[model samples]
Target: MLDLPPDLPRLRTLRTWHEQCLREIDRAIAAAEEQARAEQQAQERRAAATPPPWMVGLQDITGTPEELHQGGCTMWAHRRRKTVTRDQARELLAAGIRACEFCKPDAELGFL
Candidate 1:
């Protein structure tokens, strides 16, 4: 006749160890997943708080409206009267130089 299982104690011990290992692995995976979620949330919060263009303390106020367009209209129609050529304005704006508050570079459509 064929021999049956020798001892059930060894089988129970093996099962217990296997179950313990599986539980530990599950805990580790859960912890990793939680950490990943936290990291992703933090990144999202940072992205939302930060500006789109990674600029410092300014909105993307690029270009101006067309209300001041005329043949003989004066340029730089803000509190301050600083005027620059279209090329110069483009260069300055491209260099991340914000418009002068008084002059209101963003309020000029001639350069646009």
Candidate 2:
């Protein structure tokens, strides 16, 4: 409970005080929204700068590694995929996993 000023003895003065409080609350809300927007932009920038280099597409039924793709490839249709390192992607390709025809991760990794 905030202590009101003892001098707000008139209705007009009380209404003015209420309006001032509301304006202060509005300012606080605006500041919070601005901060949230700035934080979200920073997070988006970070995500864009450090994307995974490779990914392994997985089989829907067995969850086994099915295809290799560059991290930015979108041609993979499987919902199950795993982020992998460049070396891991090469190893998986060498171990008989198929490379995505569209993305051609094997060629990208110099495997072909």
Among the numbered candidates, top TM-score falls to 2
Shift in Å, residue 97, candidate 2: 0.8
Candidate 1, residues 1-112, lDDT tens digits: the string is 9544579997788779989999999999999999999999999998776422111122225343222112122333332223345555555566656544444544553343
Clash count (model 1, backbone only)? 0
Quality of model 2 by C-alpha lDDT: 0.87
Off by over 4 Å in 1: 1-5, 52-112
Off by over 4 Å in 2: 1-42, 45-51
**Measured by TM-score, how close is model 1 to the native structure?**
0.45
lDDT of 1 at 64: 33
Task: Rate residue 66 of model 1 by lDDT.
Answer: 21
Name the lDDT of candidate 1: 0.51
Q: What C-alpha lDDT do the candidate models reach, one value each?
A: 0.51, 0.87
